[model samples]
Target: MNVLSENNSITETAILVNPNLGHPRFLEIDQKLKKKKFQTCLLFISDKRDPAYIRDYLNDRIKIVPILDYKWQSQLLLERERKEKKGFLTKVKHFFKRKKKQISELLSQKKIEKTQRRLESLKSRVYRGSPIFPSILEVRSVLTHSIHDLEYINNEYCIPQDYLIKNHAFETLDVFYEIKIEFTLADELLDLFRIRNFIMFDIVQEKNGITERINYHSLVVSKNNWHDFTFVQATDLHLAQRNDRIYGIIKEWMDTFKIENLELIEEAYKKDQKTKKREEQAELFKLPLKRRFVNPNNQFRIFIKLMNRKVFRNELEFVVLSGDLIDFTLLSKLPKDIKKYVDFDYDFSNWKIFKKIVLNFPQKKRRGVIKGEELLCPIFTILGNHDYRPYHYDIRWAGLYRKLGLKLEEALAVNDKLLALPISAIVKSKRALRAYWSQVNPLNDFSIKLGNNNFIFLNTGSDSFKNFLDLITGHPSLTGLTTKQIIYLQNLASHKIQQKKENSFLFLHGPPINPKGKRSFLKRLSKKISGKIITKLDEFKESVIKKIGIKKDTRIDGKFNVKTGTVSTNWSSLIEFCKNYCNLTLAGHTHSLKEFRLDDPKGLKTRVFNAPPFSLKKVENPAAVYYDVYSEIYTSAKDIEKAGPFVVQTPALGLGGYRNPDLAGAYREIVIKEDKLDSFKVKFIDR
Candidate 1:
C-alpha cells in the first residue's frame, strides 16, 4: 500500500510509527514532528500487541484494515545476517582489526595518563583492608575497552544504517509502500489524528506474510464531549526486573567496609569450616545476603491490578505517570560466576520486565480467545533523574570489586564517575532513550487538550552534574529546565490563554518550589564560604511556614526539603507560568505528599497545606462524600478552596523517599467535574 500526501490539516490526531524499534529512527521522528503545527490526539504503535484498543478512542473516523500474512522482510534479513557464519579468512581479518584498535588505544600517551589518573583517583577513595588494585595490563585493558563496552551494551538495539535505508517498511512523515493494499490512511486519518507531537509505531507483519498489522492507540482530544472525568497521577515507579538482595548487601558493604566481600568470603570459608560454631558464623553472613528489599516490580503489578479494577468499574479515564518509571536506564548483568539463588535471569532489564508486565503479548488461543493483563486505559509517562542512570551503582560496583579484583573503594570511585555522566551523554548513547521511546511516550515535553482542560507535561531532565559540588552536595538546582522547554511551555500557556481554556494543569518531574529549614550554624557558615567559590546556593526561605498550619507533617526527615532555587533551572519562569496560567502544578521528585499554594504571584512565597489522605475505596463509589474527610483536617471550605492554583508533590509509587516501606506505593487521584478542578487526594496502593 502506498499512501503519500503533503502536510494537510485533518482531525486532531497523529500516529507515530517505528517499525523496527530503532533508537536513531525514533530520534529522527522526534525531530520531524516538532515542525508540525496542529492540535492532535497522538496514537502511537508502541509494540506488537494488537491495538484493538485504538478503536476505543478512534470511533469509526478512519477505515480499519485487517492485515494478514505480512512478514517483516527487513527484520528477517537482519536476523539472517546476525546468524551468518564467518569464514577463517574473515575471522582472521576481524581479529586483526580488533587488535589494531586496541594497540592504537594503548599507544596514546594522553589516553594512558588519563586512565592512570582515574585508576589512582579510585585507589585514593578506598580506606579498607589491604586492597587489591588492577595491574598495569588490566589498567591498559580498561583504557582500551571499558568505554567501548559500555557504549556497545547501551546501543545494542540500534539497527544498521544499510538495512534501515533499504527497508521499504520505513515510513515517517508521508507513508510510502508497494504492498498489496494500495490505499492511503493519510488523508482519512490526518484530520482526526492531526497532532503536533511525535508518534512512533510498532507495525508487525501478519503471519501469512502478505498483510500488515498496525498496533495503535488514540488519545482523547477536544472532539470528545465528555466533560467530567477522573484520572490517576502516579510517580516514581522505580520498576526493576527483580529486587536482588545482592544490591542491598553491596550497599551495606560500601557504607562500612567492615562487611566487605562478606558473601564471597563466607562461601569460601564454608568449605574450610570444620567447627560447628564456624559454620554458624558463616550462615549469619549468608542471612543478610539473602534478605531482599521491597520488590518494586511486584508493587507495580499490584498497582496495575488496582487500576484495572477501577477501569472495570468505569471510575477512571487515564493515568499520568509523572516520572522515575524505572530504577535505572539499563539493568545490571550479575557476574555469571556468582551463584544464582533466584529463579529469574540476573540481567533482566526493566524494559523487558515492563513489557511483560504492562503490555499484552500474542497468546495461544483458549476456546478461540486470547488473554493478557493489559491496562484498560491510556498512560502518559515522562523521564526522571533515575531513568537517566545508565547502570546500577551497586551491581556495577560489586562487579568491579569481585570480578575485576578492584578494591571496594576503587570500585566505588569508578562507578561514581560513570553515574555522574551528564544527561546529554546518557541520551546520546540511546539505551535509555530507546527503552523510553519504544515502551513509553516519545516526546519529553508535550501538551494535550481534552475538552476545556489543558494538560501539559515537561521533562525536568536527569540528575544535575553541573560541577564537583553538585556531585558532592547533591544540589537540586542541577535538575534542568532547558530554554527550549521554557519556550514550549510559554507557547502552550499562550495558546491556552488565547483559547480561553477553563482549567490548565502542569506536570513535571521536579518541583519548582521546595523549601527547607536552615542548617546548623557552623555548617551554614561553611556552606556560605564554599558557595562563593563553587556553587551559588539559593537562600530563599519561606517566612510563613508556621503560619500555613499543615496538620499531618510527613516530612519528619530533612532529606525531602530541597532549597527554593535549587530544585530546577528557569525557576522563576516556571513559577510565573504556573501562577498566571495553570490551575494546578503537579510534581513528584521529592517522593512525598506535599502541597503548596502559590500565595504571592510576583515572588517565591507559598502557603503550605496538608492534603487529606483519600483512599481508592472512597474513589470507587461515586456518591461517597469527601466533605467529612476535608472538614476534619481543614477549618473551612474556603481553606480548601485556597488550594486552587497550587503546586502538589505526589509520593513515589515504587521506592520510598527515605527507603521507608510505609511511604512507598503512593499515588494521587485527581477529579475534574464539569470542566472544573475538584479533588486532588493522595492514595496508597495497599489502601
Candidate 2:
C-alpha cells in the first residue's frame, strides 16, 4: 500500500511497502505486507534532531515514541545529581589532597611558575568570562561528571536522556528511540530467504535553513525456504570532509616545506648543472610534492556506488563496516601560519561529513556526492582506533621539529598536554563520543541475529598517549579489550552456545594476533644496538618456525603470540573463547588482507596462506573484477569445515596503509549456502 503524509505528489511521498528496500529478501516482506497489519519497531538514534519534527513529518502513518519518558528521565537525572552532591565533600577533600601533591612535585621540579602560567593561559583560552581558578575547577568537575554519565549509561539499562534535555549533560547523549509501523506480510514477501532492509525517514532542519530528510536503514530476515545469502565486509574508511582543518594544515605545511640538498635532489641538481639544463633545474625546484593525505570522502563515495550496483542487481544482502568509520572525532582550527598556535577551535565537521556521506544528503553537491548513491543495504559498524581520536595531530610536525633540532614534545608542549588528557577529560570538548552515539550505534558493542547466525561486535578501546614513548611508539595495551568487554563476550558466547546457533561470527576493530615481519640482519643489529630486547617467547617462536620448516615470517600470518601481550589483556582468554565458540573472526586495524585457520581449539596448530589476486580485466559497461580468492587460498568449503574456524583481516576501504592506491577501497565478500560456509573472497572498486 502507498502511504502519504501530506500530498499525493510522488516527490514527497514514500511507498510504505516497496520492493526496493535495498535487499531482495525485503521484496518478499513487501509483498506479504500488501494489506496485512503486522507491527515492527524501527529504532534510531537522535542528537540535535528533534523527535517532534520526525513525528510531524511522518504524520499519522507511524507512531513515534520515546524509549524513556521525559518525566522519568528528569527524575533519574535529579536522583543522580542528589547522589553526586551527597559525596561532594569527600570528593573535594580528595581533590585538594591531589592538588597538594601536584604542587609539591611542581615545586621540586622548579616548574611551579611555569605550571601556574600554563593554567592561567588555559583558563583564559577555555573560560574567558569566568574567574580563573573557579572556572578551571568547574571544567574539571564537569569532565569528571561526563565520564561518570558515560559509564552509567553504558553499564546500566537506562536510555540516555541527556541528548534530549538541553544542558542536562556535558556531552550529547545521542538518545535512542523507537517507532512502530503497521504493515501486512503477503505471501510474496515470504518467498525470499535472505537479509532484508527496512528503510525509515526522519526530517531535520539545519541551522543553515536546509531541510534534510534522512533515511535510516535497518536489516530484518523474512520467512523463506532459501539457505543462501551474501554480505560484504569493509573497514577503516577513515572518512573525512574535504574542508576539514587537518587537510588545510597539511596542505599549507607541504607547500612551504623544502628539502635542503638531499641525495636525490643533489643528484638532480648536479645533473642539471652538468647539462646546463635551466628548464630542468627550474622544474626540479617546482616539483609537485605528492600529498600524504587522500580525500577519504571520495573513496567512500565510490565504494557506496559499487555496493549500490550490487544491491540493485540483487547480488548482495548487507554490509558490515568493521570500524574506523572516520579519521578523527574532531578537526583542529589551527591557522595556516604555524607561529601563532594559541587558541584552537575543534568542531564536529568530520562526523557531520560522515553522516552526510552515509545519508547521501545535499543531492546536488558533487564534491562528496553519495546522496543519490547511499548504500542500498543496511550496515553494521563498530568503533576503531582512529574513531576514538579526539585531537588532530599533524605528523608533519614531527619531521619539521626533527629538522629544526627540536624535540617534538618540547616544541609542541601545549599540544602535547592537550593530547595527553584522557578521553574522559575531553568528552565535552570533542564531539566524537556524541556524534557516534547520536548518528551511529549508541552502544559501542552490540549483537544482531539473522536466521540461525549470530554476529557480535566489540569495541577495542582507543589510542593511548600516556607518555612521550607511547606518543611515538604507540601502545597496544591502550586499545586492547577491557575487562568489561571480555565479560560481555563471554556472556554472549554462552548465550549463543545455549541457543545452538548454526554460526557465530565475531567482529572487532583490533586484531588479537598480529606479528611483525622478519627483520633483515642490519635491522636486527640496529635494534640490538638501540637496546631492544627479544623475549623468550620470541625465541620460542623463531625456534618453532625453524623446526616446522616454515618461512620465518609465517608467524606473522599464522596465530596469536599470546605472551607478547599484543592484545595487552585477556589475550589467552579471548583466544580460548573464539576457538570454543566463534566460527569466524574478522578484524581490521592492520589495513592489510590476511587469513588464518586454526584447526585445534587449543590454538596449537594454524594454517596460513597468501590470498589470491583480483582479476586484471574489466569486462562490461558495469565493468568489475571478481576472484574466488578464498577457495584459491584455502582449497574448498570442505577443507574450511575440517580445518577452519578462520580469522581474517580485510584491507582498508579508504586510504592505503602502504601508500599504494590499489589497496584502497578494499572489501571482502562472504557467501553462505545450504547453512554452510560457501565462499569468502576479496574484491575492490575498480575505480
Candidate 3:
C-alpha cells in the first residue's frame, strides 16, 4: 500500500510488516515497549494463544474494527512448517537455500512496508511516550584485582574511566574508590627504629581522564588512631638528584660506598636537635652555626645520615619531601666525561654510590624532593618538575623510588591501610594540565601520614605549566589539571570531604588560585562563557598560548592552554576537604608569598594555610610547615574563609639552620608543645 505523508526532512521513509510472522512476536513487542517506560495497547491476533484470563476480555481493552483474510500469513506459515519438518540434513539444506531465501525476501519487503505503514500510521498516531527495555541487564564481571608484577596495562582504551552510572535500578558492578600507590622500599631493606608516619594522596579522575586514572592518595589514619596520631610531611626541599644526576644508579643502590661522611653530617644536623639543650650551654663555646650559621658539609651529612639510618630503622611513619633537597640536575647541562670519571671506578657499590651522591650533593642551590619511609613523623613530599625531572613528558621511571631498595621503607613508613593495596594496584598521583600527553594511571601516587593529622602529597604539574594551570586554575593551584580533570575534582570534592573523620592537611607544589581576584581579568575583558561550554570555545586555538584569564592586557594569574576552554572552573571539590580538615595546604611552586582562606559564615572552623616560598627564586613557599597534631579542627567553609592569613612564615631547615627565617620564629617545637596540641599550638623542633 502507498501512503503519502508530510515529513520533517527531505529523506525517504518506509515501514514494512510480515503478516505471516509468529504471532507471539506481538506480545514480545508489547513487553519491550513497556520496558522502555512506555504504555501500549494490546492488539491480539484472533488465531494466537491468549491467556485464559485475558481471552474472555480480549475484546475489552483495545478497539477492533474488522477482520482480515489469512492469505499472506497462510503462505508464510506453510513455508515455516516445511522448513521445520524436513529431515536433519534436508532441514539444514532447506534452511540455507529455499528457507533462507524466503525469510530474507520477506524481511526486506517487511522493512519497506513497515516504514511506509508507520508514515501512513502517523495520521492516526497518538502521542504515546517512553519505551521499555528488557527486564534483565547483561552480566558484567566485577573488577578483578590484578597483580603488580604482571607488566602495565597497555590497552589504554580497555580501562574505562566511568561506567554508565547505575540509575535508580541497581545491578552488580565493581565499585571502588580508585587510588594510587607508591612503593619505595624493599623487603630485604627494612629500615626501622625511628619516628615516622604516613602521608596519603586522595586523587580523583575526571570523565575525560577516566581512561587516565586519577591519583587520590589519602593519609591512611588507622580508624583506631584517627584521634591519636603523629606523622611528618615534606615539600620544596629537593632531597637530591635522581639516578641520572648521580653517576652510578641502577635498579638498586645509590652511592659509590657507605662512608662516615654521613656520620659527620648527622652530628652537625643534631645541632638543630640540641637547640633547646644548647640554651643551657655557654653562649660563646657552642659551635659554628647560631649566627647566620651555614654548614653545607654538616647539613648535607645530616640528611644523608637520615636516609642511611632509615635503611635499617622502620619505626618512624610517613615521609614526604616536597622538593629542592638537592641540586643534582647535571650540575651543568654539559655532558660528563665518562672516560675521565671511569678511570677510577672506586669499585663503588650501589649503596656507596647512593651515599656519595647524597653526601656530596649540592643543597645550597639545587632543589629536589625525597618522599619515602617516615622518620620521627610521616612525610609527604609535594614535588615540582624540578623535584624529579618533570615526567610531564615521559613515564620511564614512574615508580623510581618504589623499585629501589625502599621496599621496606614503603612497607614500614606507610600505614598498613594503603600498603595493603593489591600488589597489582599502582596509581599515578601525577596529573598533567596540558593536553600534550600524560601517563597518570591508577598505579602511581604519593602518600605521607602523621598523628591524627594526615598530609597527602600530589605530584601534579606540567611542562607548559602556565597553560596547564590555565586548564586547571583557569579552574590551577598546587596542581595543574585539564578540563575533564576539573570534573574529576568536582566528583572528588564529594568524596575527599566524606573520608575525613578528623584534621587533615594538604601537601602540594602549587598555591591555591582560588576564584578570587585571579579570575577577575578573565571575567572582564574577554567574553564570558558558561563553565560548561568553556571546553569547546575557540579560545584554546594557540600553542604555548593561554585562552582566558586575560583582560585588557592584564593577564590573570594563570592561563589556559591546549584544550583549556573546556575545563570546569571550580575548587568546590576541596571545599569539603577544607571544611572537614584542619588542613594546612603548604605550597612553594609559584615562588610568590601569599595566603588566604575560603570558609563558611562562622569564623572559627577549618584552617587553610599556604607556605610562602623560601625565596621567590626557583622554589617558592620555603618555610617548613609544622602541624600541631593534637588541636587542629575544622569549621564551616565560611569559617575557613574568615580564618585570615593566620600565623604563618617559618624559617627553612637548611645547612646551618633555616635561612631567610620568617619574621616569626619556628611555629612551635613538637617535643615541647606536646601538651599544647589541643590548643592548636604547633611547634617545630630543630632536631
Candidate 4:
C-alpha cells in the first residue's frame, strides 16, 4: 500500500482505485493489466445512489479519451428538469420566495441599530427621489477638503449643528457649490459607519459609471459612529488549503534532477518509470491542486530565518483581522462538530507560541505581551465563516451593510480607530457581532480626541444586512418591489478624507465596488451618503438659491424649474458622496484589491486600500458563486493535513480561518503620531 516515488514521470495505463465503495474486480483488472501497452487515463464516475460497477478483465483495450466535460447524463437530466418547470407566476413566486428565505436570517447587530434598519425598505421607497430625509437622523460634517489640502491640514470633520441633534431625526437637503472637490472612494466611507438607512444624491447632472467620478454629495449619515481612533490595524494573511501527495512525488523527482524544463523533465520522469506500470498510466495528466497542497513545513529552515527579525518584534495597538486565518472548518453536506472528532489542540499551539512572544517582559526580545506602559493593546477577534463559525454557525455582517449611510464625524472616528468603534466584523460566533459590539462598548460616544486630530473605524454588513433582510421579506416597503429595492437596503455610502495639520485619517469598509460611475443603485446610495458628509449638507441648496455664479436651470425639490437642482436620474448615490474631501480609504470583502487616487487640480490625493483573504479555495456549493472557499472549521479533518504545531513561514500568505481556538491569525498594529499617519499595520512573524 506504500507507493513512494521520486520525481518520476507517468506514461502508461492509469488504474482507478475505489477503496471506499469496494472494487475488488477493478483491483483484479489492474493486476492483470500491469504490463499493458498504451496508457490508461483513470476515469472515476460513480452514481450517488447506486454505482454501476464494471471492469472488462477478459478483453481490455487501452485508448485515450479526452474528458471534455465532467459528465453527460447529469447535464441531460438538468436540461430536462429545466424544460419541465412551471409558468410565469410560478417562477416569479419561486424567486421571491427564495429571496425571502435568504432575508429571514436574524441580524447580528445592536438592538437599536437593528430596529433602525427594519424600517429601511419604506424609507428607500419614500425618499429615493427627494432631498428631504427622515426626522430621526444624525448628520456627519463636511471636510472642507479637496484632494490636495486635507492630508496636511488642521481641520476636524464634525457634525454640523444644523444637521445632527442629539437623539433627533433629520432629512436630506440639496447642496451645490463651485468649490474644488476631488476624486474619492465610496466603499471606504460607508464601511466606516456601518450605516443602515440612508440615500445618495448625485448633485451633478450627467450619466456616469462606477469608475467615473461625479461631483455630487450625500445629505444624511449613519447615526452610530466610531471614536477618535485609538489606532486600528488591517492586514490580510494568505494560506494554502491542501497539497497533493502526487505533487510531492513530482517535487521529489524534480529535486533529484533539478528539472527546470517542463517538457524534457516530464519525458525523462515517464521514461524512468517505464517499468512501473502504475506510474506510466498517469502520464501528462494534470492533477488537482487540492490534493497537492502539502504544507511547506518541510522547509522549516526558511521559517527560522524569518523569525529572527526586527519587524517581528514590534507590538501593536489594535488588530482587526481580515478572513483566511486558518482553514479549520471545511464543511460540505451538513457540518460536523469538529472539536468532538478532531485533535484541534495542535491548532492553538502556534497562537500560544506567538502570544508568548508578544507577552514577554523580562526578555530583551519580548515574547508574549510585553509590558511597555501603554503598549500591549487588546486584540479584537473577527471570524471568517471558514474558521469555527460555519460548523457551529450563524449569519454574519459581511452579508449585511451593503452600501450607504450618514454621521460624518462618527463614521470618520470609527474608520480612524477600529477598536474605538461600535461596529462588528464578519467574525462567526453563536453570540453574533452585535452582541459583542454592545458588550465591548468600545467608547462612551465612540469618539476620541487626540492632541489635534481624530480617527474613526466602522464597517457595513450590520445595517445593510438588516435592511436587506427586510427588503427580502415582504415587509411593507418590499411588498411590491423588484430587485432594485432588495439590493440597496435603504442606501449605503462611503468616503475617506485626511486632514494634514490636524493629523487625522479616516477609512470606511464596505463591499468593494469601484468608481465606475456607480452602476448599482445601492452603490450609488452609498457614495452619495458619504459625499454629503464631506461637503456641507445644505451648501448645494444655498448655492442654488443665491445663483452666485451658478446655473439657472438645475433640478431641485422634485419639479424641474429654472431655479435650483433635483435628483439626477442618472447620477449614482456613491458619486454623490465623493464630491468633496477625498481621503485614504481601506476596505476588504469584495475579494478585490484596488486603489484610487483622487485630488483636486491642486494635487490633493485620497488613497484606497483593499485587504485580501487567506482562506482555502472552495470546491463545494456550486449552485451560487461556483468557486470554493474554506467552508467550515474542523477539529479533525482526514482529508486535511494539520499544521499549527509546525511553523507557517510565509509573511503575508497564511491560512485565514482559525485552526486554533486559542488565538485568531495575525495581529495588526496601529501607530499614531501628530505629524503623519494615524495608521496601523497588520503583522505576523515570518515563521
Best by TM-score: 2
Q: TM-score winner between 2 and 4, please give it.
A: 2
Which lDDT values do the candidates have, in the order given? 0.44, 0.46, 0.27, 0.23
Candidate 3: tens digits of C-alpha lDDT, residues 110-140 = 3434433332222111111111111111112
Number of clashes recorded per candidate: 24, 9, 161, 138
Model 2 shows how many backbone clashes? 9
After best superposition, candidate 2 residue 472: deviation in angstroms? 3.4
Query: Global CA lDDT of candidate 3, please?
Result: 0.27
Report model 4's TM-score to 2 decimal places. Answer: 0.26
By TM-score, the candidates rank as 2, 1, 3, 4
Residue pairs whose backbone atoms clash in candidate 2:
28-189, 29-189, 32-185, 32-186, 33-184, 33-185, 33-186, 36-184, 360-371
What tens-digit string does per-residue lDDT give for candidate 4 at 1-687?
111111111111111111100000010012222321221112111111112112221012211111111111122222333455323223333323545334333221223234223422111111112111111111122322321232212221221211111211111121111111212213322332221111122221111211111111111221212222233433323221111122333334445543356556456646666555436333313343222222322112122223212111222223333332332222211213443442222222222222222222132331111122111222233323233222211111222101111112222322232221122222333222211111121111111223444433322222122223222331101011112311221121112323333433332333212222112344234433223421221233323334544343111211111000101111122222222321233333222222222222123222221111122222111010000111122123221122111101111223222211111123333444323333333344432
Question: What is the model-wide C-alpha lDDT for candidate 4?
Answer: 0.23
lDDT of 3 at 402: 23
RMSD of each: 23.6, 23.3, 30.2, 33.7
Q: Which stretches of candidate 3 lie over 4 Å from their true place?
A: 1-226, 240-316, 325-328, 331-379, 388-455, 462-479, 483-500, 513-582, 590-597, 601-651, 654-687
Ranking by lDDT: 2, 1, 3, 4
Better of 2 and 3 by TM-score: 2
After superposing candidate 1 on the true structure, give the runs of residues whose Cα lies further than 4 Å from its correct spot: 1-226, 244-292, 334-349, 360-372, 395-431, 467-471, 474-479, 498-501, 517-568, 601-641
